[model samples]
Target chain A: METQLQLLNTQGFKHTIRRLCYELIENHNTFENSIIIGLQPRGVYLSSRIVKELKEITGLSNLVNGKLDTTFYRDDFRRRSNPLIPNQTEIDFIIEDKKVILIDDVLYTGRTIRAGLDAMQAFGRPKKVELLVLIDRRYSRHLPIQPDYVGRVVDTITSDSIKVKWDEIDGQDEVLMFTDNVEKI
Target chain B: MSALSVRHLLGIKEIQASDIDLIFSTANTFKEVINRPIKKTPSLRDTTIANLFFENSTRTKLSFELAEKRLSADVINFAASSSSVSKGETLTDTVNNILAMKVDMVVMRHPYAGAAKFLSRQVKATIINAGDGAHEHPTQALLDAFSIHEKLGSIKGCNIAIIGDILHSRVALSNIFCLQKLGANVMVCGPPTLLPKYINELGVRVETNLKKALEWCDVANMLRIQLERQDIKYFPSLREYIMLYGLNMPMLESLKKEILIMHPGPINRGVEITSEVADSHQSIILNQVENGVAVRMAVMYLLAGAKQ
Candidate 1:
């Protein structure tokens, strides 16, 4: 966090957040029956942070603790002998009637969110599903999907990539864009 | 053994040697899958596999379900509710209803050991027994054997000790058959009451003490002691049971460092084996968990594919 916060200060992200929040509040801050759901593993943490921030900003606490394993939906199962254990996607609240805002850490190929959608149908259909990703690495759009919100717009070549480090999983918070050169790192 | 040739893997021992060869070979084909740029393939596309577990199942059901989805087969899941079975419906009826859907496969777990084997003959779809009536959980044995071969380069003459719950575990029985079939020397250990007297007929030695068994083996498979269902009073108490049969840190320290440890989890942390020993560098439980999915994928593919 110290490193990321330092980097954000240097990169001027806090300044942007201050400006963006006001713009977000002024123009687009109304929803009838909305809930935020996080994708599992790390997205669970990402969505929860967003929920807390959103609640603090808008006094909304009707956030849902939902996780999607979507291991079943991945295109490559023949390769994965033991897919990630499907964790329980517990949403006691009715999903069919709500306008759900899906939250995730990184929106790469958009496959995870696509799988999350398949998992969501089991609970019930949401009226609308808007996606929020922490980082948007503009790449191949395999599934015709786009994030409704992106915290950072990072452009990169295929070999060089944006890697996210969160304290929950990586014990630090910093988004690093690096080349995947074996010799480089 | 083409790994992806299986249709549905219901049990290990139920199938012929040809099928086992098929599963192993198929698994080997996709062995490089783990290293691929994207680890996935669509094999069981559009097929539905429901994990109808009437008992708590962790590795077996999860492995099979993952294997199915990886193959592109759709997976439906159900577990024994604390209350559902008692109110209505028999295992046969439930299984039949699932089979009636003409689903590709039904991965089942029941308290009765031979239930999966019996269900296999009756169902049109394949029935892979997760575990039943202390009869056998064939896939666990297969994965264990696979892990052994992968580590030792062969299963021949490996000293294997299956400790705890032989009287109540299908894993112990399946290991006996698979290890013997794969040419490993097998030994069974636990309290006198927990082991059947005639267990030696399965071509393995039986001993009562754990240290003796631990000292004599290259691989030790610690079975989870189901504490809730021990109505017959096998051991005097849990503390006594741990003292006698539990593999603690000291016991692990006493063993040969090269020895590979294994457990079919969710482990009874401090009971059958301590957390240190279970999570120790010696443990192959996690490896077993990994291989299980591959083995099941091999099993499922072989069962469903070759006949076609």
Candidate 2:
């Protein structure tokens, strides 16, 4: 039997998102020249929610948002048994000389972000790049990557896994941490 | 979080249907990557790959090398003509010597069938079969199926006819296996003498008449007759074979349903197909060639990324 703990409920999740939107507005007054790219599979959900909040609060309707697939750019692609399931990467606009914000659901070993950075190079060289994540798992990063914006932080052991569920995808909005039976660290 | 299951891509027979879908999915991402400005990824950084070709090749060799470079892997080329095999060295010795230099993977093309499979067992490094004689060219089949899937929107229920020298084509064998696994209706169209003996056992239909085959198929993959592989004449003559099996504009236009034209190239332009049909809008030969790089990249990346 694994131990499960609820970290954030619907109300708390909404509050954290609204706060994060304000923080983003504080830094970026108007995202006229900035683009938001969500990492595929899970990050797109969180990024889409954030974009909706940003639009309601900041009235920024012309924001450029796209999904970035990091499947082919992953480093540990050969370290497992099952075949990879890839998602669509639909970036129709240019990232050249634009401030790019990369979004994901959770931050753990930071390998996915590293792959995202490598993948973004194929599009064009961005003037500046920033990372944003909803949940940040501290003391577990393999790479020296730090997110520019974060919703929540939690300290976890190697045997623990953090899962974020969105209402759009999972029919509920919440964050959960499971301990024991974590296969991959 | 998904990864390729096989360490070595030896042939289509060794791969599952789901694996083919995975390769196409990964190749889809790579195809987008190649179209971008940078056209390179650092996924395989610090990894070294050696391309060992025991046979003469133009497209496969160059495509594999280019795919390696695009993945940011250190690449080394070895051809039998320039290597120590000319100095009476054995295949094992040549490969072992190269492995001693610390190569992590090998993309090999050999003149004999089962060469890649044998080498995979002997070597500690990953082996990708570029082509192993008449046994299989898994990557080519993959790219062909991918191109068809891209153009036709789905592979299932599509009638694909492989026309030409079915007796001695690795491409034909691999394509039949792959297309059948993906639920496509496959047929082999060629001269009776040039057809394989046990082709029926493989669950593929054989059509001797080229006109009926072309009219029946949604896509026609014209194969080059392997003149070098034939020890004796399998057909009456080149002109007779062309008269019976050759694909021309009038014959294709008569099909009326806009059948897609394809070829595994180094094309004998006027032999298997005319230049007009090869260059027409209905032809996806160039798309197949372009998809070859992405498919090979996906294969190499998945194979190299597999666990030892």
Candidate 3:
């Protein structure tokens, strides 16, 4: 059996997004020299929402945004039982010599972020790179990667899981934490 | 959420329709990857691929090599004419020797049909059949179908006609299987002698008249005449075959509808199609060649991931 707990509801999710957007605007004033790249699969939802919130706040209609898929850059190729399926990478704009803000839904293991760093080199060498995440699972860092902008920091064990659900994908905007419990007879 | 249904890409016939869909979708990503300035990925950095050609090839070999390199896979090439094949060493012996060096995958083209299948049973490495006699050329078929799918937006219910030598063409065989699996209505057009005897069993419509086939289909994939494979004359001569079956500008313009033109290369300039038609706006021959690399890359990537 498993137990589910709702960490952030719809109202709280909206507030967190607004705060993250403000923090981004505080760092990147005009964002003329900066770009937002959404990591593909689940991260795309968080990135797109962040981009929308940032655009609404700054009124920058021409904000450069792209989606990147890092399946190919993962170090675990041929190491897993199931094959890794890749998603579409729609980065039409160049990231050359610009500050790239990579957005994802959750931060865990940090391997995906590492792969994203490697995948970004294909587009061009960015002047600077930063990572933003909606949920930061503390004590789960496998690689030496820390989010530049984190929405919420939650301490978790190795076996625990964190899932950030968005209205665009999961039909609801909330953060859920699940813990598996095995009962003895 | 999906992996290839089969471990090895032996032929289009051996895979399910979902496999083709997966390959096409993966190729779409690789297409973007190849267009980038870097044009390379470190997906297969630790994997090693051995390209063994028991038959002579130019484009398929080069395309596989390029795909392997682009994916960061260390590649080794073997030409039968220059290797132990000339020294009367058996196929199993040669491939086994290569496997002893920790070769992970084998991309092979052989003059005999079922060579790849045979090697797969004899060894443990992944086998990708480049082409085997007149049996199948899976990757070529994949790229051809991908090009059509890209241009037309969808492949289902599309009227696709394959023109020219069907009897000796592995491209034709593989294309028939691939297109049919994708839900496309396929028709083979060629001289009676050139069409395979058991082609009707494949459930494809046989059209002897070239003009009628062109008029009936939304896309026409013109196959090259394999003179080297044919020991006996299937038709009277190249000139007569061209006059009857050749795809010229006049023939294309007379169709009353815009149909995509394609060829699995090494084109017989005036024999299968005219130069004007080959270079026409409707021709996607070069696109087929370009997609070849991406499609191969996708296949290698998926197969590599499926490896145990």
Candidate 4:
């Protein structure tokens, strides 16, 4: 337990520094002017996590909000079994004049991340936009884009997948990289 | 939870006897939950469930979503107009992507028949079919049975009249099959065109006169005549429909015994049945709605959370 917390506190600081560095360069060194938008469920929770780390270290308290849903931005909606249901889109920070750092858990096929982008557009335009993820599967990049900061990279086969279990949602915090239930722990 | 298990639940026709019995009885556990102060449970804790509805529905979707939330699951919402459906995503692909995200289960209501069942076949997630086109609404039947079982103490020997748009109602078909299985005399009444010829094969007695069906039944379940389904000429007019078969106060008063009034709503308030009659002591429409969530939760846990 102590080790996990220690790793999170230390590595989380490193992750925060990296996240803030991109914002500083893109926004021309404006410490007081940036925001974070989290995707629904995990993505939103992840942004809040990173925001905590970033705020504690930088003491700037960058604005944080949650992207409601990207279900509507799916590439194939015509034959949808059931289309996206509208939920609460929370944005405490004004995206109109601030740099937006979109945060999520995994970025695969770039679809969900794209959906997050579309959801951000509905909120308001931002001066700059960047991406962050806990794990980059390093595959399924349908769009010609990539995350600005990544925690881990696993060269994954299409057959197997990774499942990140956090206590907030799954009753535990474990960054697992599994392939067909086989582990590389 | 296995990928090779039953696919998306579009209806109950393709289900087996054991699974059906399990669902019906599992729904019985919630009889207490339904009557409690805070009718909720934490069985689905930390689970995120999405309700993707391509069609407009109030009772079914609300009840199903409530069922998920009551089980302590996180809920996601979707609609047809602003969702990916308008963006050209195929149903299977959308389901596959969402499945990829690992949402625990999906409770869906769609206009297409066999959608829920089709989804169940492809993915490993649990499927609960809210309603599909005119094909079926299994949870509706389960809840209607649950309510009937509550009132009559048993499902046997009760005569139930399913009156309204028989042609376009999957509810009528499911009720007939399920009610008859539990020994209820199933009477289907509607316009000749609205009643299919194959209904007789299901052992349901068909009549064009709503009054005739009403006189002989213990429960009268009215069906909504979909305005969209009428474009191809199933009726003369809404005026003609209300005059001929609509349930009004006088009709309720004339019935010798108080037969239960039921409608799978978004009710056409004054068209098929009057609003006053729908809210009367004899009407179980709201009870039907209230029971839907418990019944759906029961249906879901029975299929997905059943013991191996």
TM-score per prediction, in order, is: 0.59, 0.93, 0.98, 0.59
Following a full C-alpha superposition, what root-mean-square deviation does model 1 have from the true structure?
14.1
Q: Highest lDDT: which candidate? A: 3
Local distance difference test, per candidate?
A: 0.70, 0.89, 0.92, 0.71
Candidate 1, after superposition: displacement of residue A72 in Å?
A: 17
lDDT of 4 at B306: 28
Q: What is the CAPRI rating of model 2's predicted complex?
A: medium
DockQ for model 4 equals 0.01
Candidate 2 docks with a DockQ of 0.50
Runs with alpha carbons beyond 4 Å of true place in candidate 2 = A71-87, A139-144, A179-185
What lDDT tens digits, residue by residue, belong to model 4 across residues A1-185?
11111123334545544665455345534345667777775777677776665556557654445554454344443233332222334554457776777878877778878766765664567888888787787866778769887766666666555566666777655565445534432
Worst window of 10 by summed lDDT in candidate 3 chain A: A176-185
Candidate 2 backbone collisions, by pair: A78-B305, A78-B306, A82-B3
True contacts kept of each: 0.00, 0.61, 0.75, 0.00
lDDT of 4 by residue, B15-131 (tens): 544445555555665544455444555445546787888888777878887787766678888787787878899988887887788787788778888888788778777777777
The CAPRI classification for model 3 reads as medium
Chain A vs. true chain A, TM-score per model, equals 0.76, 0.94, 0.95, 0.75
Error of 3 at B257 (Å): 0.2
lDDT of 3: 0.92
Candidate 4 ranges beyond 4 A from true positions? A1-185, B1-9, B16-21
Model 3: per-residue Cα lDDT at residue A31 = 93
